[model samples]
Target chain A: MQFTSERRLDGAVREREFALGEIPGILWTPGSVSAPAPLILLGPPPLGLRKTYPRLVARARHSAAAGFATATIELPGRGDRPRWPAAEQALAELRRAMEAGEPVSDEIVDALILPLVDRAVPEWQAALDALLSLREIGGPVGYSGGVISIGTRLAVVEPRISAAVLFAGSFVPRAMFQEARQVTIPLHVLLQWDDEGNDRQAALDLFDAFGSKEKTLHANMGGHTGVPQFAGDAAAQFFTRHLK
Target chain B: MQFTSERRLDGAVREREFALGEIPGILWTPGSVSAPAPLILLGPPPLGLRKTYPRLVARARHSAAAGFATATIELPGRGDRPRWPAAEQALAELRRAMEAGEPVSDEIVDALILPLVDRAVPEWQAALDALLSLREIGGPVGYSGGVISIGTRLAVVEPRISAAVLFAGSFVPRAMFQEARQVTIPLHVLLQWDDEGNDRQAALDLFDAFGSKEKTLHANMGGHTGVPQFAGDAAAQFFTRHLK
Candidate 1:
């Protein structure tokens, strides 16, 4: 079940069409495949990055060159599709979670928040499950990880997520982080000194609560978008070390 | 009349009280004051730094110590008793200006947006007018200026504003740098590398449109809040050089 890079009509850069159950995806591999090489299932930001930015393409290329199978799959309701009404749905779910005093686990949070991702969670899950199923068809899948920005980080803390490299992403309240502490995984945070939209310090404060030795921090040189190169490199290295 | 350090309050800083003209503000003079020092009114951000953040208070204090009569005036819809729906009003005005296809002047923009600055502009203007009306007021009331942040910058481009210092603010498209170029007054922009909510590069790109000699750019090390200290010092210097 080897994947090859080719242009797909879906407008994905170097896409390989595949299906997880009935959910279809384009497996976009960046470079040459080799043994013990990691596979990066990139979860895009809330407004999917594939159509809006070219940096994702650059990241996939770089990661593939580093002996990784990078797939930049399309999330539902993004890219020439009718956009999901995320703001209203997210606010409603946030209110519900707050009222219920429910511990916001990855699954619970995703179930409650997928509609807000601007691409439904079930679709994302289907794509993810499809990517995971590739492990059984092929050989051992060494790594499973993602990089999220701004609002996109909300979906990356899932139990299935092996490791994450977050960039100026928002964090749940202190209570939510505290409740989900047991499910902690290795996380690397790249924070900017003066980022206002996302409080870099607040995110750091939340990361500190993880209390896991696996966490690492890299302060970026510029604001939000400046870290694409840094994130791509760090993510590849992290995948190599942990996933391999 | 020389003014001395009076008092500092520590708590959730009151934006409405300041707006209602309840905060005690001082008039400073180099010698026995004869005329009002040309006023440079600054409109604080919608989210008051002093109220919510300690770092902002320290920065404000530093600016006050630097010889300017500094006040953090509240924007509308943000302080305790808001006079206007801040963001909504601002956005509506912006849309109107854009649709009209006319360049926004400082007065025109201010007239449309001042309700959004809450009572900050009027309070400062009242104080300045009173001080200038004094018989003993010695100095020539030759200039009026301001520093605008976020939405308030739209007000600074008024023809009457002899000088201005803008930080992490955006322009109203066509109005962009037209005010800066047309106004004979000097303008200094203290921009953050990565402003949280605003488009940093887009704002910076407007600088090129300004008449080169009339404008100066200070790319300092901070996010939005991080700018107050660095920007305050630079602004104080800018005011001294131009406003005085």
Candidate 2:
């Protein structure tokens, strides 16, 4: 990991931009810690880091208030990173289905999400490796945010993430159901009950398929992006329960 | 309302046993309070108060520690309260169906839950009237516990109950679905996801049916009585968020 830039978010939080190979990421740490703070990986919605920065920074600042470090890296084809034609083609197909008001087929979901999961999980793991190596960031790690397929794959494969808070999103590949059954870490899943474009039953089924012995599904009354503030507090409490 | 007994649970809480006519109930209040404390009515199952005292007292004490006065009343056919023959016959039918390993029909459910809700809702309202009249108790009221059908009815009818934490249980009458739609208070619902002998789909449907603009369903991986301590803590947090 090479530090590219740095700035203080506030007196309590410091933000550092870094580059790990070709992946660009940001890390936030508490200004001072008596010991190495617990780390939370703030997974974004494949929306690119610049667009997702405000929400990520809010979560990072909140975690810093409780003495934790948080980090996020750009997905393979997201943000300023290079994009591939196949990924672009899948996105076009997904848009066409939505424009025609047709149900998003399993094939389309798999085509769009499977490759993203395949490419993104490795980058996340690489970022995790570098984040943990930093002197200020070490302890039980947590992953919070979505494209939940990537979170599911990470929970199944990443030994360092002791807990996760997954936002239930649409376009989950059916094959990810099999991967979900391998996830054993404690999980806190947030579902927007009335998200217009999301598949509610599919989200519920994925929650049901999780292999974790301790999993919680918090379904709230809202459209997508309408998650309430209290819900965020509950998710933070979940992280505190497992990571601390 | 007549106080039958009064005592201190600890340095922080005071416990008082009371009678509203023939109905028996207990109230817990913070040991020291400047303003009138907020109230939470801790609803228990139809198991009778003697059987459910320990759990009720624990919740009461916990609420009191948060500077909230808490209370619970025995249902008509429960605790030391007089038992009706109709209620007795309903319980007999319910056990017989369960012993035969037959699915609990809606008829059986209505027979069991409807009468309790009918008898219980008014009593809870009356208790609210008396509890709120007390000098030590005031502010926003919350109801936390089950027979979920009772909670549903109370939430719809008792407007002073500005918030509630409803424990999802089996044997809900179909009629409550309509009443659930009328409940507009902020709600925090807890469901034991793998609860033995409980219908998970029905629970999910009830959660979906609730009309509250701010409602949450927290489904945990556990049996009926296996609600973890963290779940309890979350419910408390919910009450604190609204009640305070």
Candidate 3:
């Protein structure tokens, strides 16, 4: 893993760009890491790790100011990664189906979701490995968004993720729901009530399925992008309470 | 609402075929309806309403033999209904994306699923309306098969359905998971542990998310189509207890 162009930011926080294989990311840390600070692995929406996710940057800064290290990586097919032309074509085809009000087949649904899940999980594991290895970060790790399935996979397969704040911006593959039962970590999931493209019922169901005895759902009435800034603050508080 | 080609079977079960608008279905009732018998509305999987779903036929037969009238309707894309060309195109696109390891956007995911949910729910409600309208069938209704989202919707919106047997053979849209919390009816969910196309975790999660206090999950070790014949018998027994 290599981190370059380190820059000092306001509040004595440090920032750097990182890359480990195809996984590109950014890391943030408090000015004085005299001791190991709690760490958070941030996941992004489908937009991946771009400036488009301002909330991510703000959340990371908040964590740093609160004395924790945070990091987020570009999911495959986003950022500097190569886009799968076939997947793009699939998206186009799906759009046509939607326009024409078509009934999708099971094979199609599997094709759209499974490959992404398979590629993302291992990359997340590697990213987590790289983040935790940083001397400035400590145990009691937390994970926040990308697509929910990545978090779901991390929660199930990565025992190190002690807590998670899942964003209900994506669909839950049916298989992942079953995997969710294995995730007994503390969780804070957020949902926007009127997200146009979102399946509101599925979000509620995923929250209900959480195996975490301490899971809480923070639902706000808004569109997909309408999550208020306060929700992020609340998530920060949650991290402070648990990760700290 | 028209019925044609009525037939009587060896077990004193009476069968009838019907067509209403674009929906086509079959109804089965016990030989004698001395009293109001509980009714079950079986939903077809992607395989549609064919001999392919022998389990469905068997379940309906079991229900009929047990003195309950049972029925099943073809999903919009299956059986006598014409396949939605747009939906098929979407499937092909999804296949390409999977083969090329492409990332699917949330909008594409929604397109792939929402249309089906929209089309299937109304058809299910219609089927319920038609079946209950039949003098041979009476109170205490049940639902089984197809993708789980249909069952989730029926459980929430259709107050007359007293119970449901959901098969974990399909994906759970994230929105449907939220709607699941509204379901308060008795439920008997079935799952095959090694369903190839299924994300096993998602099925378990959907089950855990169900809000019903009177719900049971019958999980067996098998493939997607490997639900043991006895599991159907168990589901029949569950219907007997709940629907009867």
Candidate 4:
């Protein structure tokens, strides 16, 4: 990881803006940690992380103040990372199938999600490795933000991540639900009850498929962005219970 | 409706093939109706009422045996009707937006549903007008088959349709849920739980938003065409309870 800038925030938080190879990101930690602190990793939004994502920054600060280090790395096609040309082509084909009133095949669904996940998950794993390597950060990792499949994959593959806060406002490939049935980590899932763009029954199905003995689905009514502010507080509590 | 051909089918059903203006279709009535019988209008499948859709024919025959005259008009772009040339172009634009990972705004959703609904709903209304005018068919109209919003729109505007059996295995505009709230007819909705191309949650949300005093959702597991044989029996029962 290459640190390009360093700063102090809210008087007692240390903020560093850096890049893990090509993945750009920000990390925030409590200014002074006598011992290593627990860590949280925030994933990219559908639009990817931008200055407009005050939510990520605030969550980072929330984690930092709660005595944990927090970090987020840009996913490809997001922030400074240029998009893969294939995503556009794949999406175009999927939408065309939809418009022609054709049933989107499993291959098309795979094209829509797998490539983006494959591109982003490795960067996330690498970023997690780099973030936890820092002297002030310790074990017990939490992952928040979604594309729920990403969290499911990470929970299954990354032993370091102890808990996850999954946003269910995105589509899950049918095969991924089978993968989700293997996710046994403590999980806190958020669902916008009235998300127009999301497949609601699929979200419920994914949640139902989760193998986690300790998993909770927090659902609130509204559109895609209708998650209430208090929902974040509940997520924080969930992370504190599991990660802390 | 102008009758162009007549035949006796499966022993006791009278099959009258007809056209409402430029639209051509088939109607089946139980051979001996002492009085005017209730009518059920089957909406065209996405592929249209072709030989592959033996399901439509079976359902019509089922409704006919249940004592309701059954009819299905050719939706535009199906059978005798030519497809709108702009459907391909609109689909291309939609595909472009999706490829770019753009949020489908209300305008885009409207673009996807309104035109299809606009083209199909009027023809359905016209067909309903013509079908009910026949001496063998009258009163309490039932509409079955869908992308579903077609049924919602018809239920809201077409008073002749006193009940509807909506197939929820299709996309719904976010605004249509509100329109669904205006649907006061008795409804029996069917959903294929594992529909690949559908937003399952949208189907549930639409079902939740229906204002009908008697609305039943029959959700079965499997792919888009996976509605079980029993579902047809239940729907036949629903139409009997309401239309008869």
Q: Which candidate is the best by TM-score?
A: 2
The global Cα lDDT (0 to 1) of model 4 is 0.79
Chain B structural similarity (TM-score) per candidate: 0.57, 0.97, 0.90, 0.90
Select the stronger candidate by lDDT from 1 and 3: 3
Q: Give the backbone clash total of model 4.
A: 2
- Candidate 3 chain A, poorest ten consecutive residues by summed lDDT: A103-112
Worst 10 residues of 4 chain A by lDDT: A213-222
> Which digits, one per residue and each the tens of the lDDT, describe model 3 over residues A1-244?
7986688877588889888886788888888878988888888777667765577777777888888898887877777798897666655675676678775444554566667788888887888888888778888899986688888888899988888988888756788789888788878777775676667778767876777766656555567887766567667777877777
Candidate 2 per-residue lDDT, tens place, A1-244, comes to 9999999865658999999998888999999898999999999876789998888898899889988899999888888899999899888998999999999888888888999999999889989888888888888999998799999999998998999999996668889999999999999999999998799999999999999999999999889888888889989999988888
User: Which regions of candidate 4 deviate over 4 angstroms?
Assistant: A1-244, B51-53, B92-109
lDDT of 4 at B21: 82
- DockQ of candidates 1 onward, in order? 0.01, 0.94, 0.01, 0.01
Chain A of model 3 scored by TM-score: 0.91
**Model 1 chain B lDDT-worst window of ten:** B11-20
Candidate of highest DockQ: 2
Docking class of 3: incorrect
- Each candidate's root-mean-square deviation in Å? 18.2, 1.2, 18.3, 18.7
Candidate 4 per-residue lDDT, tens place, A196-237, comes to 767777877887788886665655556887675655766787
**Candidate 2 global CA lDDT score:** 0.89
Q: Give the Cα RMSD of candidate 2.
A: 1.2
